[model samples]
Target: MSQGIEAADDLAPEIRQFHEAINSGYAAHPPQPGQTMADRRQVAERVRAPWAAGGPAMARTDELRVGPRGVRIRIHRPVLDRGLPSLLYIHGGGWMLFSLDTHDRLMREYAARAGIAVIGVDYSLSPEAKFPTALEEIVSVIDWLRQDGAGAGLDPSRIAIAGDSAGANMAVAANLLLRRQAKPLLDGMLLNYGAFDHAVTPSHQRYGGDGYMLNSAEMVVFWDAYLRGPADYEDPLAVPLRADLQGLPPAFLAIAGCDILADGNLSMAAALRAAGVPVVANLYEGASHSFLEAVSISPLADRALTESATWLARRLGRTCG
Candidate 1:
């Protein structure tokens, strides 16, 4: 083992505390069983209540029509008074949980550090809304950003797309969809520990059991709840690792070393490079899935976010003070 990984391995105490906090938070109010789609929607809405209350409030929050769904979005403007690049961010919850509110703190930090406008998309959740629903909502939000974000003091042409975990999957898919249509292009993409395939990789098999966090069984449960049927697993939008990655925007991908999804993220980065895309991939030693959310407290999380924002700022051609 390298020194970096070895050092990260020694941070077990902190990682354990982080895990306990997250598990306790979720255990307090687990998702209720849903007998119908409407019931599931109700459950999802209730699950989001805590997230809505957890983070700092953005400069502006509003509801906008993204196709047929009324998508909720929060805009965190740059702390400095100037025109800034915009980011359309998607939150991670394995597709079944989480929303803009859950990721508000991270988004605020990005906006403050990167000097960019951060737009958090409250895309539809799974089981109730299912595969294409979230994708469609995300794409529609991108389209809306291209149209209205400029008037909101952003440079639409300098917009980038970003997300964590399942949201990262949606980000890649939305980018691909836009490319296919030859429509508005994104300046770049940031994918953080996203799951790109339903097919099990070595990491999944190796870490299928507990102790690593995000076990294969939990992944299976999340996938089954998010996808409509078995056939949807083959869809590129659902499993972006299965898609052709050519002609996409430059990408910055971050993977947690101990995450079950680690191999999948590495493979996606390799594939994108093979397809001639500029890709910068980072593997944070000793980190588990969803470590970015701990940035408000963890030193390692703070460092990772700082590096991520620096990469993003470079791609967007903006300098941060």
Candidate 2:
């Protein structure tokens, strides 16, 4: 249902180069027939290792278990200052793949740039945990933060939720649940190329293929794995586009122009604005999904990250000095 864009170069030069690097890594480690999920994760780790390396270091870093489920969380603090604002960052791997390690550098970057503590959550994966499981764990993390964050050196009242792809979906879903339950809501949301709806659109038809990094067929597989059945298609928690967008906090959506989920991300921004929530939707032209992972090489990625860090600082009441 989203309109199509026409451009000579589908992706920017740097983004295209980033794709080449990732594609080459996959080509080097071709998938075996009938490979298990563990094996697939191994391949992904190896492919993504280069991108996750060497970013700004944190003044203090710690790993601890939180919530009743004891969800693993890695906290990166830019400084040892107590009561610092926090960003509860959920990593995106379609609820199936990747981990905290895959996104360590990005978390560090945010912490350094925004001068805030970045908490990376290691939520349960899908097909094994299924829908609502990961969502619940995320909500549990939020609850834990609000209740016990000051002990952990964070200002719980200034917390924000952030993620990309499926993680972004869960971020919004968790906030929606909190709002519905009359619980204290997060101060803001930083969503990067989020998959808000399951519906296919013209963008999916155009850019979902080998070069795009995420294809339509792979999305189907991910959706099938995360969801229980047809019933989940109507559930707002599973597909946030179906939810009542009112009463959520200010949001910043980093939309990748050349990605399959572009349309859905755009739709989400529109919905948030319609609900009277302050929204800043930034569309990066010629960018692909997961382009933020290429911050080391892509200027576009760097610019986006800098902009997002600035926005997060403003929304969370921090001065980006």
Question: Judged by lDDT, which candidate is best?
Answer: 2
lDDT of 1 by residue, 1-321 (tens): 000111223334555456655555445545566556565434544543443343444455444554345677777875544557888899887887766766777787777667778888887777777888888888887777777766666676788989998889988999878877788668889999998887788988765555565778768878998888889888887888888888889999988877889899999999999999999999987787877766655677777878888988888887853
Which parts of model 2 are misplaced by more than 4 Å?
A: 1-8
Best by TM-score: 2
Question: Per-prediction TM-score, please?
Answer: 0.86, 0.96
The per-residue C-alpha lDDT of model 2 at residue 181 equals: 78
For model 1, name the residue pairs that clash: none
Q: Enumerate residue pairs that collide in model 2.
A: none
Give candidate 2's whole-model lDDT.
Answer: 0.89
Q: Tens digit of lDDT per residue, candidate 2, span 1-321?
A: 111122226789987787877777777777789999998888888888899999898899999999899999999998999999999999998888999999999999999999999999999998788998998888998999989999998998899999999989988999998987789889999999998899999889888765677889888888999999999989999999889999898999999999999999999999999999999999999898998999999999999999999999998888773
The C-alpha lDDT values of all candidates are 0.75, 0.89
